[model samples]
Target: MAFWIFLPITLSAVSLIGCWTVYGLALRFNHICSLRNWEYSNSCLTNKTVTGGCCTEYNIPTISGSGTQFPENSLFSATINAASFLFVIFSIFHYAHILKKCTVHRFFSKSAMVFGCLAGVGAFVAGNCNPGELMFLHYLGSALSFVCICFYTVLLTFLTSTCILTGLERFLYPVRIVFSIVQVTLTILYCIFFTQKDFYYRHISAIFEWTLSMNLELFELSYAVEFYFFSSSMLSVLLSNRDEENTMILS
Candidate 1:
């Protein structure tokens, strides 16, 4: 039970760190590529030329091309795809373990299971969605991934709040509350700004055109929330032990 909480946290931390590293590398590559009027190949770093193969005159790299050279954003996107898929696997394993223990509330356990399934589905859908294309299927997959993250965020927030309110522990309530608020806010904003047709086509595309490509921020935030939740849970266990010790001494 104790280990289960740590698993998600550990995985999320690793993912977040990996994402940051990828982002940095991508940025650096973009800088170098800009000087050479070169851009990263979409999908992978193959050396072949495809449609939209070159860096735009404006210095922005295209998403698809030969795999020989990768732009920073392309590399970041690939890393995110890989890390997110791995995290989904860890989430499923952690949820399954918790389900076996059944120490948490029935609702929490069931919710975790559902969220785990959704995350897996999201990963699958997103994997199939091409980053370089603006097709409906691509957007649909992205939307599904966002939805899965939102659902999981809500369930985790609810479970954390329940733990706080039920007097499970005291010292970690602040952390849990902050974690819940951030995740809820991110989820709501994502639905409104990224997922909705009005915002996606009208606002995002009109203004930034590449708004979806910048979803790295959301990914980082999601991982941050997961890490905090795991840390708070582990801290709660420690606080519980201290409380028991005090109670025993007082009695």
Candidate 2:
């Protein structure tokens, strides 16, 4: 049971480290343009940069942009798939934990699970559909993931504030609220800047995207505390067919 805490820990670690690794690899391969050179001309997009230079519009270094290359794309897809799978398990575990410990906030718990699972599915889709080729699907998946995660965190924060299921709720509630707010703020900024044609705004949006991802990873990391209290029995309860509507109704 104590080892369950590693689920969230690994999820956060894999997502954060793996994505940046892909970005670094993409840079090494010149698959994507640099993020630091603010003065880099848009001519880079027209093959005007030096020979063999990154001559693409992917100057943003977005997680999607960073993974548009060959080997890096493979790593990127694997990382997102792994992280998304863990997120689905995390959602299930959190819901089961709530059912095991609390009698109230069932609606919020169920809603959080829906959003969390949808977010995971979106991540999966985005991972498998590389943005360079499947731009529509990739952006669709990214949008779904972002939007669902925003709702998921807000609902989870609400549950944390109302229920003391986990002993860490007192601290976690405020912290989750802060994360939720920042996540929403960054999501909005990322969306706004993402639409601009100017490379500067696009680059800023990329920064927002990376920050949003790191913030989410940190949020997931906080749940390691809650997972520390998890038990295998909680999952058994969730899987049991016998339902007591009078007590806990998962449906």
Candidate 3:
């Protein structure tokens, strides 16, 4: 049904808007330094104080850093968790679509499904494990999510180019290929910059992170075209295990 297309659309829109809203709130509440003057000036980042009266110096605002404070932190967590849930659904639907549209490339489809699900799990962990409180766990989750997502996109793009899931493969193939390349490139750059100590490098890393996320959202949005031809029955068949059903009935 055409209405099913809204799933990917909503996932992309909510993720983009929710993360930006959290960033805006972070700026408003002085949770992180502004991008306009993204610098540590006289060891004072903002006039406002959440804990003590003291103002703390900070680097350029990354999404995680921006959501480390009150109010905004709550929103950030909610947004990430919501996106994560949608991601899992999207993965399942894509898998079902592949199953319905093509009988070949079963290995690629299965690998993509596994990686996509792992990415969702990592997103969930990253959302719940606050970077400020649980730095190690949060970083671990973020790393897993990024790496898995990169793999997922590559495999999905390959499948799109090879499979006839959508008659629009001629268009989606090239587009997804470009998105996959950019995603991998930016992921690498973000990791490199993330390890730097200089302010400029750190700030550039934040920019890369933001760009990486937006690219991913756009990539997901492109799947709305596929969803336009989707049916809920596809997912049902994908989930139902005939052997398990037979075993249960016999028992």
TM-score of each: 0.51, 0.92, 0.90
What's the CA error at residue 177 for candidate 3, in Å?
Answer: 1.0
C-alpha positional error of residue 175 in candidate 2 after TM-score superposition, expressed in Å: 1.3
Model 2 misplaced regions, further than 4 Å: 48-56, 241-251
Alpha-carbon shift of residue 149 in model 1 (angstroms): 2.1
Query: Model 3, 48-86: lDDT tens per residue?
Result: 442223334353678888888888999999999999999
lDDT of 2 by residue, 78-158 (tens): 999999999999998999998888879788998999999999999999999988789899999999999999999999889
TM-score of 2: 0.92
lDDT of each: 0.45, 0.86, 0.86
After best superposition, candidate 1 residue 20: deviation in angstroms?
2.4
Clashes of 3: 0
Question: Which residue pairs show backbone clashes in model 2?
Answer: none
* lDDT assessment of candidate 2: 0.86
Residue 109 shift from truth in candidate 3, angstroms? 0.7
Task: Give one digit per residue, the lDDT tens place, for model 1 in 131-207.
Answer: 45545655576566656655665565555545432234243444545554555555455455534433122232212
